[model samples]
Target: MKHLRYVPGLVARGAALAAALAAAGLPLVAAAQDLRGPLGAAPAAPAAPAGPRNMSESVAAVVNDEIISTYDLAQRMRLLIATSGVQPTQENLPQFQREALISLIDERLQLQELRRVEKERKINIVADEEDVDRQLGELAQQSNLRPEAFVTALRGQGINPDTLREQIRAEISWRRWIQGYYGSRLRIGEDQVTLVQQRLAAAASKPQYQVSEVFIDANRVGGMQAATAGAQQLVQQLQQGAPFPAVARQFSAAATAATGGDAGWVSPGEMPPEVDAALEQLRPGQLSAPIPVRDGVYIVYLRDKRGGAGGTLVNLKQAAVALPQGATPGDEAAARVKLEAIRTQATGCNDLEAVAGRAQGVVAGDLGEAEVSDLIPAFQEAANQLQVGQISQPVRSPAGLHVLAVCGKRAAGAAQLDREQIENRLYGQQLSMIARRAMRDLRNSATIETR
Candidate 1:
């Protein structure tokens, strides 16, 4: 059954009634100052020291009338640290914990607002069984695990499957509410889309200059002065006709230093704003004076600029084979063999399904047509190598193994956008900003209790 899940404490009738009454300037049952005290101030120090023995039951703060347990906050912090791959130490753990707590408070607020909105609108958002099943299937496929294995993984993480499902359902319900309330009013006119297209085209047409640079690290001992000296010295060498790549390979600390810091052709938006600004003033073969970035100094020299707008129309085709959960190592081997057979027999996308079927696999999906750069590195390489109607060898990706065929190709040139497209893009930007503000306000007004 569809359920409307309310965040505890924030969803109570008394809380909602109190908020309405407060907004209407009614006298409070208790001192307004007492209730408002914690709203803007830093959290009070814990009554006792937080250590292993006391940590589980510690009260970090009270949100409205609810307590935020220290253990819950710690669990969230650990998850965040794991996902970000950051090592938590004594120096950083406190900061991380604080940030995690704030995030929890924000989430609670959002959930509360979702509940309030649902009540006001008299809507019951339910998660259909089919939707739940589909989601679980997808999750299993992603983890390369069977349903049972995936459930075990969740259990190992100390997560309850029912709680996780409830969270997902709540999120879905809130999204539906947002769409019903504001989706129609969100307008993206043609003019905005056209403007965006024009900008994209203009950017594409601009000459792309490849450059090599060296940044002297300033954070190490004697680093700032050494980098500064190195920048001046490198600039003099460039003026003396020393090769930029040679100097970059010898001195730059960046990853590209090995290749003489050869930053491939970059357009305006492709670089940091400061770098883009500097590049604008530089002509081909010109070198810049020392440019300072964070904790370093850079010596840059322009290598070459080439290419104007209009690139070729590359027709890219892909056949993906999605493996279902419970597929073992044997299943993976079978999938690969099947893909190879399809590749051997395929002439074009038209032959994909038949070939796949013969091999006991399926044409799981298509990526349709794509620009070369729009594809991932492996797919891009395969696509670029293929001739029209030629099928590629099966390649593995995170999504699955794919066989590509290039159906068509086009060369680069100048293109312009019509007016309608411009307006729509602009409208999208405006709507995004509006939505952010609305969500922020909703959060600020919510009586969130985190426990």
Candidate 2:
């Protein structure tokens, strides 16, 4: 029941490609326009192209006789910008492109590895298009739009949703391939789970950080100097309002980079003394200076923190009727009317979910379990008095009017959190380590050439 914010970073790495061109002072094939579509107003483009012809025909990088065409990189960048809200400005473009190229290289290596392993084992990686369709529909729903309208909106912005599809495919395929290739080996023993559970119990009442990281590996040829420079640029890019998740996707060597470098709710004691002290000095939404850690340098983003985390972990479901941006009096009135009808008709989570399904610009979702300290002070105070099966009066946020129903709540205890959560976290770290090593090995063994 962790209140985790999930921002899939696989496609965000695609934005890294344009970063390559920018770093080299090369212009993009086309100037990025005022893009307002599915995600938001995307950033501008990179350097202008060499000529009129499509860069798709031009080679960007070559891998084992395989080609990553310029067209691929350009389209990937556009889609990533459209989705992740990362802007590509002149100053940051080069750095972004450099990171993109690296991600692209890693992606190419992964695809190659997946295919080779598939062929050797006589296995197929099946990712149903239906799943993609479902995901697309769900994404469209988040914006309070229909699936086809969402695609049309993206098309209007010159962003192709297919690029997103391919990115999702790569993630799906890589996960399936890894699971198939290393099935039982990923499992944790009972003793290991118990130890993890014990640690959680001991650290349950300490200060915790919602941390994200961008890591630059010094193990490569140029050593610490080159790596430090990379970290410096990454920090600057982030400071300039680049989405941390996208940058992390493009640059982090750790497995968490796959999920935007999210190291969910780490207690202060869990962090190294240097990292812990660095975090202690910062407030939420601030970045740390590049910290040297063994073979690499890490730039951490402190997202949120808790001071002595003892509290109720409340789980609530909300049905919100969102007014359009720049809503007029009439729009607010209409939204209020709709919300009133919904509030009266919906008495439980299932009922509210139905109302959300039928109402446009409505959101029906579990707010995730959060410590009482984590909730906004006002909302926390209001929710504190409610028992299970109780609903709160409409709370006004800028987005719209929300009616929240307490789905469940409990005092923090070992039993409230299960073994699976701990196991998955452990397994994810293990998988990420293995994946990075596998990718490194593939790069070492492969004949890669850049154009």
Candidate 3:
């Protein structure tokens, strides 16, 4: 399953919902406030003291008449700390408690809905124990531990592993329920898919980014200030070596949250304007700071980037002589002499190894294969100038002096958009919009009290 991650620009929900969907890292998404509203104003229980405190079975809050026990809230806090790798401290404890409480309340609401649907509709979307175990095993695998060992680690941290299990259960059930309820009703016509394809083809000339994201929804977290603070806390944990995917799965509100926020290859203008701008400044492996836009805060990680329309792919071999950075004219002359001599004996790339081996202080081997435009400027010029199986005059670069051999060249095509993928993206987006509205309606109609 695609795990309910949303697509952007597929279905027309309200602008805010569309923007929220777009903000996440999904295949195709067109992709805040003070902390003084109900959630922020709702008093959270005091943070339990460090270490194992006495268990309290008293009510923490009531959601639609379903009780959220203080014990439940505490367990979830421990679970959040264990999974998110966020430190539980006096300063951050209240924040953690609030987040945990909200999570618990949401779960209660979801379970309530699931129960209502199953009873009234006679449809069982409830995830069985086996389903929970399967998810648990997958999560454990992500941590590079066996399920038993993963449970032990959580126990070691004084967290009840069952808390994590129950959370996973809710997630699975909710995902199933949403998909079942809305999947059939949403439709993507051939025309819609074609339109997306046309858009993708038109944008093929723009740079594309392989990105992953973590979106903190301001409304869900209480307000803009609260979301920002939470984002900063998450960022701190990320910088300290917490895994991005794991944290995203636990905390990000985007549909991509299920798949660790991998957006795949997104062209310019695909992401929200602020996110797109942030991506422009990010290099591969770099993580952006929390970017506040109209609807939420986004933290993007650029996995890679590539030029538009692709380029000529080439294979080559080289013979080179190393020179220090500050090499004098005399040193350059000497290195050139060595490479020129090697070039004569090396009739083609086939002779690169043996001919260069005969020269003193020379290094030679295949330079591998890569797109011409992706190469360094010096190499790009050399590859373009040289013919297949031909050797070039000595070239000077920052590395040293080199004689290049062009072994092969081929035109690489840009990635073409797929119709099925486009259709699926659109369908997923519609379902996501429906799910959001359904949840909102549920929250609005339900009687809820928080303490």
Candidate 4:
């Protein structure tokens, strides 16, 4: 139910790559002629060879039939360095160049796979003008440049404007391809939603314990023994009743150290496996033994515990009324009146659907039991103030006016999640892994030649 926004950097990368590919004369764009510079303006020439060619040099790697040129690799390195703001030092140039070349090769492979899938699936994926314009706008904003200024800057950097646009197009195309091929099949079922809701409800009701922890970064230390020894000393201090927060502030390497390593309120599953195991055996106000975490060790102390019925539940229904085609005063008033009538007839939560049905003009949706925070702010506020089984007045949100009903409530505390919720979470993780593997496979088989 959480709405996520697109990251600007991701959009920029896609756009930049599209531009680069377009410049390379790749068959990514259908209307290539439209992207060409002004008539009579000379095409930008490719950079000259930096060194003599060796005839006997073997192929670095082959992706299908395409060849990756050494020259292309060098250019990609320079561009990556310039874009990332990483200094192109003599000591780091070779390493950076190697990684950049690999990344380019992977990108090409993904593009090839996307094209193949699109053809086989007969998918029509188009990047609209608005999408491109938005990406361009974001990129320009980041660089404090106007669209025209950004294009000019690309030209100054030996990057053709068409090339950049093509790069963005390719990235968008690939994302669309992925969505078409796999997104629909990736689903979270009703049971999973219910389970998460229950788990959240339980977590809210459970006692919240304040704890201070010291985490020794084993990865930074020489070995596990060094980390263990550090943790042992910290535990000894805690046993002697030394203040945990002061110790943590002085020695903990984690970001939480700034807050004296205070982890606000941790539920059982929220803590690391080892830490959770240790805490399970300790009573409130108890100090845990050194707990091993990946590449580190932690010493935790239970500072205090607060108990309260914390969870809230809502039994709600929605009526989606379409706005009139044209926004006239009469149309608005009619819609408002219809919605108000539905609210007035609904005696309680049980009557919500009946009232909606009788209204005839409105469509009803059931949102069953939901957490307050899970609903939109306006809806959450309305639900919070209503008593169980109470019907609310019609409220206007962007989607339309919704008449909500609070059928029931549940107090917060820890509770076991249902199987459906567990499976859904697992499935989500599986889908992520699948996507990553697909990308990796494409990268491995791609043929790229860099200069």
Candidate 5:
């Protein structure tokens, strides 16, 4: 019954990846054409190869004895530019290469783990080709092209479509692997949800911010200086024209990076203290300079804000048993009796529609969400009086004898942390943390060499 906007799943994340790239203002193939110059200009030619007869055969990095080839890095770099909407200049080429290489390494590690798991368990954990195709369809649609056409565009840009495909495969596989491994073990108790609810209620009078972020982990990128530099560059790109979500998808190290770095609505103490301070200074639609946290730098984008004490919004559902405009007392009484029967049988809003279906002449559906005060007097009174999932006794409206149910409510500027939402939030946080730790362990034990 809660009108919460749940976090997106794998397919949605994949769609967002393509959507962000498409919305970045870069022409489909122009990104590749302008690697060494501003868009619409000819790119500079590369110098002759130094070592390998086939330059693509040259090694870029070695991950646990597996090689990531120069060709692989180049394709990924182009994909990065295309997806991130960052103008590839000589100044940023090294940075892009580093990012591309790191991404390649992570994918290698993830694939290795998947193979290990499959071998050990004798089960296939890899994402199916159909899943890849579905994700590709979403990506292509975002580019305003059919799947075949989108593939052509990538090829024209000298990008191997398989680069994108493999990236999707790795992400899908890794996500599934993590969720499968940890989901059942993670539990969110009623007490945890209640604690979060209590915290939210306490902060209900403080300001609330709708925030998105780009986090650069100092350890991942090398050190504090490098992370700070990366954060500064990302902030610059965002200020210039790069889409925040697009950049976020490419560079943010936070778990929210999977969903374009959306941190959703947060109160004062919800985020790190430093980030909270930075957010306070930002107006809606403004970007904050990189703020140094203990392990990383954060670039926050304030999407919107509202005072904590805003009006109440309600989600309502209604069942109306119709009668004639000037029906006889018998008719009204009969309608009320029918409605009362339905109400008594209905335990909550979840089953209200089905319960109403049992009786004739009963029309049951949601009245939808609205501010409590904005609802008409009859509905408003009902909404103000009933708690979530509580059904009202039958009352006569102009059209019929009606019973209303309160499905959910929230303060205008706040997000409702319902039981399901809290569980999901905790699940994601733990999963991401575990995944990161797993990757860190792999990195620690593996022999990685860069060329």
Candidate 6:
């Protein structure tokens, strides 16, 4: 099942609820800075933007009775730019606007459907202030900022917290509606769980792929041509640095769209043949083009993979020297010598940071709990050979030399699945299909006007 059920707590994947979802790598703005990627107050006169004029634009889009004004459009753009940390050049702004407009349109459709469902069922699904607060708190945690400070930062960026709240409300409300309506009928027999266990046990030694998904529903289109074109555009935007999770949250018709399209760790047999073939062609951090299937177009991002199923995850730290600009082979050689010396001195995990501090251009920090495949190839190999409290010899990369230490490791296995886990698995599989159909019907009936 698609894992899009996380409430506002998921900032990125954890960010699943936040706008510009999955914005962990993006720096948050300060209380005083206006949304321009860390630039502070300016006394100097601002230069004119050297591009085609987009000023004087009016209402950008309309969904049913709701209007998204030019300011709303601009604010949304600024919010995306601010939170994503992906600066839009003149070259890509038009494309960004197109995708952004599409996303906003989809957001409206989702919220509208949520409202309609509530009215139809005589349910009150409004997101209260407390719900908004919790959502903000989760988003702040992803950026390592306090919730109040995060709110202040967002306001500084001209992004209304209420807009974020509405998004959260929509996410939460729609999920509740799906569960309330279909969850009762969604069931997993004990026999089904046993069958899955037997299959997994048999294939325990085979490779498993950890993946996230972005599905564009072409089946809803009046024509396959238009759907194909829309899917292609999404592929282009993702290639151009749009956050996959954010796009999924805004536009995916799948239920896991709520969790930012996280499908969790899927094995070869679990995935469709078309998807498996596509997965074979990409490595970790790579995305596939739109793979046209019978019902929709799928663009999958490979998170990581392993030779076997779940294994030990380690808490790791690294101490490294950042090579100076224009450093030569001799300079690299000197850095490696220093790293080896540091390696001996930083033999223990606790000593790693201090050893790095003594070296020039060395930056030391934690790598967090992660699997071997989660690291770069060289680091993965070196880590696999090390024991807890053991420090690696200098690992070389273009940036510089590095030494790593393993703080701890823990087992992660298939036995972790309990009855509740099995039920959720069943729920998600059924819910995604139901959610997709519901969204399709909603879109089919909606009156959307684009400028």
lDDT of 4 by residue, 1-451 (tens): 3211111123444333334333432221222111111122222233322234334334344567766444344344444433432233444344444444554555567667776766887876646667767777677766666887766656555444554454466556655655556655676677666765665566666555567777876643435787787677667656765456545643454444445567666665556778877766676788888888876888888875544356576678766577634556676677778878877777876777877887767888788776676678889888888988777777667666677777777764434445654564445444544555566566445544433
Candidate 3 per-residue lDDT over residues 215-311, each given as its tens digit? 8877677789988988888787788886777667667777666566777788876678999899889988999999998767999889977666746
Model 1: lDDT of residue 267:
65
Candidate 3 lowest-lDDT run of ten: 26-35
Question: Candidate 2 lDDT, tens digit per residue, 4-108?
Answer: 222234633433332322232222233343221112323333332212334325666788888766555655555544433355565544544454456567667
The most accurate candidate by lDDT is 5
Find the 10 residues in a row with the least total lDDT in model 1. Answer: 28-37
Ranking by TM-score: 3, 5, 2, 6, 1, 4
Question: Which stretches of model 1 miss by more than 4 angstroms?
Answer: 1-56, 64-66, 125-137, 158-170, 207-432, 447-451
Best by TM-score: 3
Q: What is the alpha-carbon lDDT for the whole of candidate 2?
A: 0.65
Q: Clashes in candidate 5: how many? A: 0
Mark the 10 consecutive residues where model 6 has the least summed lDDT.
Answer: 37-46
Spell out the clash pairs found in candidate 3.
5-255, 8-28, 8-29, 8-30, 22-31, 31-271, 31-272, 33-224
lDDT of each: 0.53, 0.65, 0.70, 0.57, 0.76, 0.65
Give the better candidate number (1 or 4) by TM-score. 1
Clashes of each: 30, 15, 8, 38, 0, 8
Off by over 4 Å in 5: 1-56, 310-412
CA RMSD (A), model 3 = 8.8
Q: Which is superior by lDDT, 3 or 6?
A: 3
